[model samples]
Target: MTIIRNIFHGFLRAMSSNSKIPIAPVGVRGMRDLDRTKFSLNVILPVLKVREEKLSKISNILKQYFLKLENFKPVQAQDAVTKCVYFNPEKITQWNEFSEKDKSIFQEHNIDHTSFSLQSVQLSYDNFKIDTIFKAVLPENEETVSGFSQIGHIIHLNLREHLHEYRHLIGQVLLDKIKTCKTVVNKSNIIDNTYRNFKMEVVAGTEDYFVTVKENRCNFQFDFSKVYWNPRLGKEHERILSFLNPNDVLFDVFCGVGPFAVPAARRKCTVFANDLNPDSFKWLNHNAKHNKVNMNIFRSYNLDGKDFICDIFQKFVSNICDGTEKLKEGAKIHVTMNLPAMAVEFLKHFNGLLRNKENTVHVEIIAYVYCFAIGDDPASVAKKMVSDNIGRDISTSILDVFNVRNVSPKKEMMRATIRLNDVIFNELQEPPTKKVCV
Candidate 1:
């Protein structure tokens, strides 16, 4: 019985060894990591040699059927020939196809097929596009990783649970494919924390978090793990800055690394930027200095949103109203509350703060409050939230309901620009009676 058991065990071990996952065969051009998880493909295309001077004419004639592979040069030197043009494999499978199916094309173009040698060229994994490589390697019917936000040298991915198993493989592929990406991170946790910075793990490439990003012709460097930076907000930032004129005042309640404040300061706008995150505050100052923003026009603070509004914001407006803070002619006060998740809740503090001083303040006050909502009418939903928090129906004061970006399939990041008119600041006082001409 013992001898029979040993024989069975040995047989089982042999079967297991034979059933081990197979590593993919080596690629033609020495592609790396061609294994069961990472794979490669080989493609062949038709090629023909021509003189360098005729390259432009031939390319123009066959531009529709020319190889469209990105980062690929269809024209190359072939021995004594100065130029060789490759055609799409799908259009011309073999040299005979050009003579048979595509014979009319040559006849129409008045080309001599016998003058040029018809040859087939092979392409390796190195020649394939990033998307093609991903589609070839990833499992069938699986959701491939496509969208990503590039901040500086880091690629941020909010991958779903289904991609968890292939996280490393996906990271490796991205690091290899993207030339500017030095680090790839996956954020698994929700961004509901106090500082709004999500915890992320470095899936591939270097572990460095410090990176410098350029936006709106300004440089900003910060620690990625300690602060929040979204590259997709570039257009929204530009849109907000468009409303500001020289000598305008900006009060950024949730400024992160001075995306709005620094650029506004450079544009000669007096900026008072604040954020609860200490790292963000530190980088805001750094970026301001780096971008050579006028120090006289830029100020940063690390304070709670409510405290900043109560102390800093209230005092600034009070100074403006009391004539203590001098302003240039046509200067306006623009408040930017960019904390989308909970910025609407802070709108209540602005309600009565501007009361009784509306007449004293000469310039207009516009509040750009950002919020996230999910519905068919997300802009209206956001407007209602702002109106409910401020305790006023600001339908007439609504300047613009801009859809900043789509946060999800149904959720949107909406910006409601509300002018601080008599409805909000004056607290519904009687309208001034019109004077009849004597």
Candidate 2:
């Protein structure tokens, strides 16, 4: 009998060391009815009956050991007649575990240190967190789906093929856990190159696509289905904006809904924003107007990227040379090409387009070109591609090469900043001296 008692105490000690509170009930895999799927966790906790008014004071004194079970109060009615404050079982199982300081505090407060009684508390499904639910339902070896992009009221997920069967469950869990989420969608296909927007299927919640997002101190409103926007690029946008000053000139060649152009205009910089997609162009004008930047400050165009580049630069050069447009002293010119798939192909247009020895002597032009490259070193590969496309060695003129983001395990999205000065633009040859009369 004594041996059996010792073995039982040993088992209790092991359980006390390894047991976790609020554990989910088993056999709920592939279950879709979230509320009806009940889970219960029964734990033997230490309970102390106290007067109703001392509940708050005792709770504060024992805050570190206060019960953390969700949707249940730590202080509750013990029976039809009394109230008690419960302590987390994982923290203490006996009266001797309390420190001398805690004992003295309890004595000073007229509370008996030996008054704790072991009581069984039952926690239900509402007690578990989202990660606990996912772990309880997902296979032991399977990957958990937790990463998502939240844009306004929508949550965007890129679930793997293995998670397809659990898509609805995953979306429902996200919607239920995230307070601000009103809709959840998954990418149904790859992004279309021309429009840069992907087809998505609503997995849960309302199917509203029109939303407004705030970034870089600017508000942008657009239909998620008609335009392309990545919240991950917010830091990248701010990094580029940090390079510009007020009254500078910015040319956003492939501006999608004027993410860069609108902010630049707000900075007091003159902006020329263009896009090929009609929806993007319309929204660009709308966003500029909504931001209170007039057409005079932020120009909009729907021309192709190449055509826009050529037309804008030529007009700019002509304006500078002929004095039709005046630039503020020390103002710089910036060109942003953000179509990562094929922006390098458009670099040749600026080879000789802005070369004017007399007019552009004091002008400084900077070009930020984004592209995708696959190699061990994607930044070097991107720089080499930019040099090859422009028909010159831009190694020295290249100011910065940044890894904007990774598109895949092997492919990377990179940005190369190139200085376009007299060296980059072909210098015009001097006409032969005429000496016919002499």
Candidate 3:
């Protein structure tokens, strides 16, 4: 009838001191299914003066027949000369069945031991997924739960229409299950294409709008209620940004909250960032200053992507021609169009981009255009779409095409990286015929 109150802390023989993996306690609650019959009956071992080398041998033997709870420290009286160690033995009454060699070690030191009354506890490795939890709590037909997006501290749920009533329960469960999330919101409206923001109702936690997102070694602060921020594209931004060098030029069209422009500027690349959404522009400026990007190198613009390209391209070409804008040899020049829905169609604006200029800009002008396409092979479809929209033959223009992610079962987001200089600046090529969509 012993109640074990002692906990022990030390690395076991198998554990390393510098392991990065997070260690869970013997029992942790994670909304998991539990079996009532299975539990550990702890055995409290009396402290003994044993050789330092024998600790491993004694621990190994204890682990053979009981649960070896590692990394637990004992709480004892301040003046106590020694502390007790604990183990959870499955068969509490079988302590006398040990071999004679093991019995000598325990009996020789007179280390008294007692068994603890069994207590229910959760296992660390249990099936605690949201799908299972939802299915258990929700009705079968109404359990149409669409997945959620982890945006900053918020769990953004765009649940299927049928699951609206359970949004609060779902949000609370998500908040409880996740360690980092503080707030949860259900999307009230679909994403607004023009502004890229969405209406949301707070289902759990505080009514908060301000959130800071860290990505690509940069921190960005934005009003989540007013601007758009997606945590999923952090890797994609870093991937393309690795191609840039100091003194390179980046024109980020539809640069929502400066995900691309701010990090590029941090790399010492000159950035001209633009977005039609006023909130995005304001946050872009704010984030650039907050991140300590050189204002001389980073400039924010509020204009449509079409206007940003047509007007800014002319100005950059003008500066390149007049020798006002200086760049290092082989410095890359990039035009980033990130509005996946319309960015590909925006390529037509670049057809006659540098044609009429007398500027001999010796820089590689590259276009990183994103789009959404539906097909089995969305990458190929995106490449052909870019070729047709930019009015260039696909054979000579494609530098690379990436299947970004699946938006849905049929729809996919893609990025087509093309060197616009090869096709646009070619004298034999005709000016692009399609109108710009952005």
Q: How far is candidate 2 from the true structure (C-alpha RMSD, Å)?
A: 5.6
Q: Give the worst 10-residue stretch by lDDT in candidate 1.
A: 21-30
Cα distance off (Å), candidate 2, residue 364: 2.2
lDDT per residue for candidate 2 within 327-362, as digits (tens), equals 889999899999898899999887777565354446
* Tens digits of lDDT, candidate 1, 277-345: 999999999999989989988888999999999899888878877889878889999999999999999
TM agreement with the true structure for every prediction: 0.84, 0.80, 0.71
Candidate 2, residue 291: lDDT: 85
- Per model, how many backbone clashes are there? 0, 0, 5
Report the C-alpha lDDT of model 3 over 140-238, residue by residue, as the tens digit: 666456678787788888888767667787787787668788899988998746898888999888787788888888899988988887777878898
Model 2's TM-score against the true structure:
0.80
Report lDDT (Cα) of residue 346, candidate 3.
81
- Residue 287's lDDT within candidate 2 is 88
Cα RMSD, each candidate = 10.0, 5.6, 9.9
Ranking by TM-score: 1, 2, 3
